[model samples]
Target: MKAQMFDMTRMWGMVTGLVLAIAYFASLYLGFKASEMLPMLVTAIGGFEMFLFSQDVWIKRKRKHG
Candidate 1:
């Protein structure tokens, strides 16, 4: 039997994506516009997730090559 590592970064990314999707649909359903700041907030969160994923990849590569 093999054990798999739990990836918090991936989990967070999925959660963020799900929340954004739900918010978008809910706003549409209720006939209300999303706030102007929503896009900026999403961008910031996505950027942070990308940074975390890149860092994880870099660390794994470093360990593999060293």
Candidate 2:
């Protein structure tokens, strides 16, 4: 299958979200809790975005083959 612009955009977004989530986790581990709720919010958004992008890829591949 050919690579599309939308796929690239999604991949970048997923990577960025993952990175942000990791950074937030590290900060929390180091006791950098400037705001308790913000870290949870960021983690939730990042995890959701990752899940959505992964589901999109799986569905596209399944559709193409089946």
Provide the overall lDDT of each model, using Cα atoms, as 2-decimal numbers: 0.77, 0.75
* CA displacement after TM-score superposition, residue 7 of candidate 2 (Å): 1.0
Best model number under lDDT: 1
Where does the lowest 10-residue lDDT sum fall in candidate 2?
33-42
Which regions of candidate 2 fall more than 4 Å away from where they truly are? 1-3, 34-66
lDDT of 1 by residue, 1-66 (tens): 122234765676768866886787788789999987766766777777788779989999999999
- Report the lDDT tens digits of candidate 2 across residue range 1-66: 355876776677777767777777788789886466656766776777778779989999999999
TM-score for candidate 1, residues paired by index: 0.63
Q: How accurate is candidate 1 locally (lDDT)?
A: 0.77
Question: Global lDDT for candidate 2?
Answer: 0.75
Every model's TM-score: 0.63, 0.52
Error of 1 at 52 (Å): 0.2
Q: Where does candidate 1 stray beyond 4 Å?
A: 1-17, 25-31
